[model samples]
Target: MDESYYKYHLFFCVNTRSDGGPCCGDSSAPQLRDYAKQRIGELGDAIPGNVRVNTAGCMNRCAEGPVLVIYPEAVWYRYQNRADIDEIITEHLCNGRPVSRLRI
Candidate 1:
C-alpha cells in the first residue's frame, strides 16, 4: 500500500453539546488542539512526515472529554492542560513513544 501522507494525524474531539452533557469542548479541547498544532509546527523535521492536527466532532467518547487520537498508531489520550499536551508531543510525537500515563 502507498504510504500515508502524514506520519501522525492527531484528531481532537471539539464537539460541544448543549444538553448539559459532558463534551470535549467543555474541557477546552479546541484550545488544547490549537496548542498541540502549534507545538507540532515548532518541532519541524524532528517528527516524521507532515504531522496534521485537526478538530473532530464528537468522537462518541464525551464521557472521557477532551480526547485526542494519534494515527499511524491509533493511540488515544485524554488531556487536561498544557503539560499533558507537551508530554504527548515530546514523548509520543517527537520520540515515537506513546505516553502511557495519559493514554485512554
Candidate 2:
C-alpha cells in the first residue's frame, strides 16, 4: 500500500436514511465535508502530503451523527458547522493538534 499518497485522510460520514434514522446527512455532513476540503485546499503548500476529504456511508455511529475520522492519528470528531470544520483544519491538519472540543 502506498500510504505516502496523503499525509492525512479524512472520512466524513454522509450517510442518509429514508427511514428517518439518525444519520450524518441529516446534519449537513456533505456540505461540511466540502467546506473542509476547500479549507484544506486553501492551505496551499503549507502541509505535507494531500489531505484527502472523502464522503463515506454509514460509519455505524449514527448516535454520533455527523462524524468524521482522521487517519494516521485515527481521531474521530463530531462537527456541526463550518466553524467546527475550520477549527479542525487549523488546529489538527495545520498545527498537528487535534481539537479536543470537537473530538468524539
Against the correct fold, how does model 1 do in TM-score?
0.95
Angstrom error at residue 67, model 2: 0.4
Q: After superposition, how far is residue 14 of candidate 2 from its true place, in Å?
A: 0.4
| Best of the candidates, TM-score | 1
Please list all clashing residue pairs in model 2, or write none if there are none. none
lDDT of the candidates, in the order given: 0.90, 0.89
Query: What TM-score number comes out for model 2?
Result: 0.92
Per-prediction CA RMSD (Å): 1.0, 1.5
Query: Model 2 Cα displacement at 2 (Å)?
Result: 7.7
Alpha-carbon TM-score of each model against the true structure: 0.95, 0.92
